[model samples]
Target: MTTAFSLAPLFRSSVGFDRFNDLFESAARNDSASGYPPYNVEKLAEDKYRIVIAVAGFQEQELDLQVEKGVLTVAGGKRDNGAQNQEKDNVTYLHQGIAERAFKLSFRLADHIEVRNAGLANGLLTIDLLRQIPEEAKAKRIPINGQQVLEREGS
Candidate 1:
């Protein structure tokens, strides 16, 4: 059984968090899916991050990456080719270990965070991220102007 959480109170008190609510709802809805092809998220630097996912049976040609509306999506899998179909038909497995199913994973990005690069090696898919704050968005010091007052009018 799953418990439902209401964000009504949080919405009443918070501002500019409309998207967060949607993310929460989507996560809750998709919680039933199995966590196949495990992944790891690592922080390489203060403003840099990397996500590595295990995709042992997937090839570069079978993988896809997309970014849209502050969301990054990674998908892996392809329709069975002739060789794969023949292998499946002829081979009998005593135990199946590796997962060769299609999967799609999505990640929400914060403002100014962008995908820098992606690479696949040794059955691991690595996605790099960088946070670039614009000059106008960064904090700046304001200079205060000083003026001298004259007392001649009072005299």
Candidate 2:
């Protein structure tokens, strides 16, 4: 059994949050597609983050990583090699539990977030991200000009 929920009420009184609401809806819809490759997201510091994915049985050449339009994409699949195919054809498995199928995963990044580095080690793919807020976008103190002028005029 499944229960459906509406996000309309959450954004009824908010502005400029349509994309945020869409993200929630998209995640809810993609819950069933989250299986296969397991992953972990960790915050290392105030502006640093790490994403680790288990990509066992996948080679470096078989995996791909890309970031575009505020989205990070990770994809993996076994390449077709003549020698590798011939070796696999002669082997038989009773259980065949290790999954080596093609998989793709996407993550929506917040504004100013950038992918810094990526590496594959010991069947794990690690991606580092950094968030850089622009100086103009950051909060700053504003001088009170009208208050001082009003005091001088009244004096």
Every model's TM-score: 0.74, 0.78
lDDT of 2: 0.78
Clashing pairs in 1: none
lDDT tens per residue, model 2, 52-98 = 88999999999999988877889999999999889998999988977
Residue pairs that clash (backbone atoms under 3 angstroms), model 2: none
Best by TM-score: 2
Residue 103 of model 1, lDDT score: 88
Clashes of each: 0, 0
In candidate 1, which residue ranges exceed 4 Å CA deviation?
1-23, 143-155
Global lDDT of each model? 0.75, 0.78
Model 2 misplacement above 4 A: 1-20, 143-155
lDDT by residue for model 1 (39-123), tens: 7766788788788889997889999999898878888886678987888889889998997889887766777888999999999
Error of 1 at 129 (Å): 0.6
Candidate closest to the true structure, highest lDDT: 2
